[model samples]
Target: MTRRRHPSLWIAMALATSSLSGCRCSEPPAEKEEPAKASPTIQRGDAVLVEPNAGDFFEARVLGLEPAAGIQSLKLQRSDGEITTADAVDVYKLPDESAAAAASKQPGLAPGRLVICEVAHQRWVGCRIKTVSEDGYQIEDFGGEEHRISLKKLMLPSELTRMNLEQRFKIGDRRRAFEREAARAGQPAPPPGFSPGFKERVIAKRGDEWFSAHIVRFHDDGAFRVRWMADDRENDVAKVEVIPEPPYQQPPKRGGFVLLKPNVQSLPWARWRVVSVRPELVLQNAAGEQSQSSRREVVPLDPDVAASDEESP
Candidate 1:
């Protein structure tokens, strides 16, 4: 070190020191990765759990995964005993094997078949598959009278042979037509020949006295036209006049009288004596009371003569 060193010897010593430092600074071994877990697959007869929002989980049988639109649909049994189908997003696969076995043992409708049920007094009757829908078959009671029901109200069918095609087709067509006509009318269905209540009144006048008469013609404006026989008239001819009330009104009272006056000039004779007062007409004698030869002699009371007499009086 005290003596002067060669240039090549100094360079070689520097190189050896750099190589030793590089060998000792290698990277640590990568950490071993844990194996990933696989999601369980859902199968038939599995006890599927549905989590609708944050509520308690509901247990139902796994009918099948029905592919529709962009996702799958899962048919489930409701706690209240009603069978329904819901989206897969609302359901989860259950891990309970015993629950799945119990659910599988329960009888279910065949595919394309549904339980057609007739409910009476809160009891189900006539339950069987009568028709098929795109996803399920219709179940109904073949022993009972046929009825119309919506498709969504039925449970999924497990088989198809139990379906009654004729009855289903007929009922569906009729129901659809009825619905179409009801929608087109836009008004509520009306009972046949519906009628409304109304009021009527009738009033008849004879000379100065007014008589209530029965109404024959009724109008919407609270007016009625009447037809009735004159109480005083002996003739059976019916007298008709438009009155205020119609359809129903009081009849004329008994003992009411009507008078018929003749024009003085139109009379056959000038002076007359009252004879008989029958219902037909007022009979009179055109004669003077002087003598037998003056029977036909009487005084004339024409319009002009009556007017002169009025002036003189």
Candidate 2:
């Protein structure tokens, strides 16, 4: 009879077969498992994976929902230690409901907290958040000048971001109006007899030639004056004088034009005469008697006139 086979061998054979069967059943499936459906979540000061491969992810804080864009833009801290922005479509909510609720109720930037001032003219400009009045915001510019801006002219930054050419023009017009008003308020008023619009004509004499200049002034007497710019400088610089016309020989009878004394210093060589005398030319003479001689002819006292008078003598 054959020797009885060892029990251990049979047991070993069964164990081997069982191990092979398990290996066949445990082989990995060919298809990949889809990532869990991402849920919107507020970011806590924690690092999380943002991408599918787990290779690229950013550390960010969940600021708020941007419903319009339909994307969550997180305030992120970059690897370089700088705060930047990152966005994701699928965001997940935190497991802690109370924490999320607290974040939602926290106060953030006020609706009208920030403003931008674009300078239309002049240097230095800034913006401020002021209480809204019926008129509009009371803003202080970079020059520390305070201005009341109309609501129509003021715009939110978000709104300004979308401004077109026409919108910018409107804003510019409003700024100009504010500047003009400020300038007017800060300037002193003109004196009773003085007018800001008064102008004067200057007559200068050189040899036999005459020249005229139109100067802008605050008074009819040419005080507080500015030099007139000549269109033709060479021709305008010739010698000239004021001369009185015929009607000025008689004293002025009623309220009418008066001749203003010309400044002799302005025209060294020119002799002044009251030219084109009006009804107001009547004035007391040196003898204390009213005389029409108040008006006289103004002429240049050139070398020729002096020589001729001497020769006549």
Candidate 3:
């Protein structure tokens, strides 16, 4: 059965339907899904700076990654054979050698580049460029000491390592050459107070006294390469600082008197008769007790001095 509807009611229903459709058309479009955030990646064997502790980063190689509890830590090894662990947040990638080299080539742009500097003689240390000058680059060390370094003394870490290894090989070769020269008939001894040359066993002056030493080689700069018998340390001894080992003298007769100093540091040289001269110098005092001393410690008495002492007594 058809029921009759009022005209106002029909018009109101149509108007409500039209309004709902318009609202749907004006709705904002669904937002596009954002791409998942990317995580930064670091691989094994990469050179990196790691801070095992807060605020203390050092150069190291990434050994591996350790993941635990949804967090990652880095296994890093330092140049000195020390292995340490650091959080991923504290690990930083270093510029590759190529990049570092390229940056170093532009000295004008080297204000913050990492570098190796030979700050003192044979002392290589890590540093950073602070500024550039017409003469050379000004560098600041890890300890905060600023230095004006010559270009020749500054290098990238990789370059310094290679150069250092080569230098060591060269020094080793020179040392071998020195050994060969020493093995051959030793060089002729020079006169006292004269400079020493290669392969000469000498009494080199250290402080005011002369000590037994030998010149085994020559420095690149022509300085005498002296090896002191006292400490076995090598030095670039200068001319006029070295002389031949003093010639040994014939021992006096058993009853003959000679001056001797039992203590090289003590005063008052005492008279003693010779007992033996081989192996070591043996002397006897008035009590007939024997004491041993080096042949070099025995000295001939000065007649004038002895006479003056006698006259004073």
User: lDDT of candidate 1 vs native?
Assistant: 0.34
Better of 1 and 2 by lDDT: 1
- Find the number of clashing residue pairs for candidate 1: 24
Which parts of model 2 are misplaced by more than 4 Å?
1-125, 133-227, 230-313
Among these predictions, the greatest lDDT belongs to 3
lDDT of 3 by residue, 1-313 (tens): 1221111211222122433453333444343211111113356787665434322336777787665453356678886788987665544455554544544445353587665565775455556778888777788665557888766555443333324433433444454543343234222233333445567665454553445567988766545777776677877766645544322334344544555543532233455667776777788764446898764554433221111111110
- On TM-score, the leading prediction is 3
Report the C-alpha lDDT of model 1 over 1-313, residue by residue, as the tens digit: 0121111211222122333453422454343210110113355565555534222235577665554664456666665677878655444444344433443344444433334232332233324455544543345453334444433232221122113333444455555554443234221111223122222222344333334334554556533444433332221112232222211112111221111222342222112332332332222321212111111122221111111111110
Error of 1 at 132 (Å): 52
- Give the alpha carbon lDDT tens digit for every residue of 207-304 in model 2: 44233444443433444333432333322221113221111223322322223233343433222222233653443311223434343322222212
Q: Stretches of candidate 3 above 4 Å error?
A: 1-41, 105-130, 134-136, 142-144, 148-313
TM-score of each: 0.19, 0.16, 0.28
How far in Å is the alpha carbon of 183 misplaced in model 1? 56
Q: What is the lDDT of candidate 3?
A: 0.51
Clashes of each: 24, 20, 0
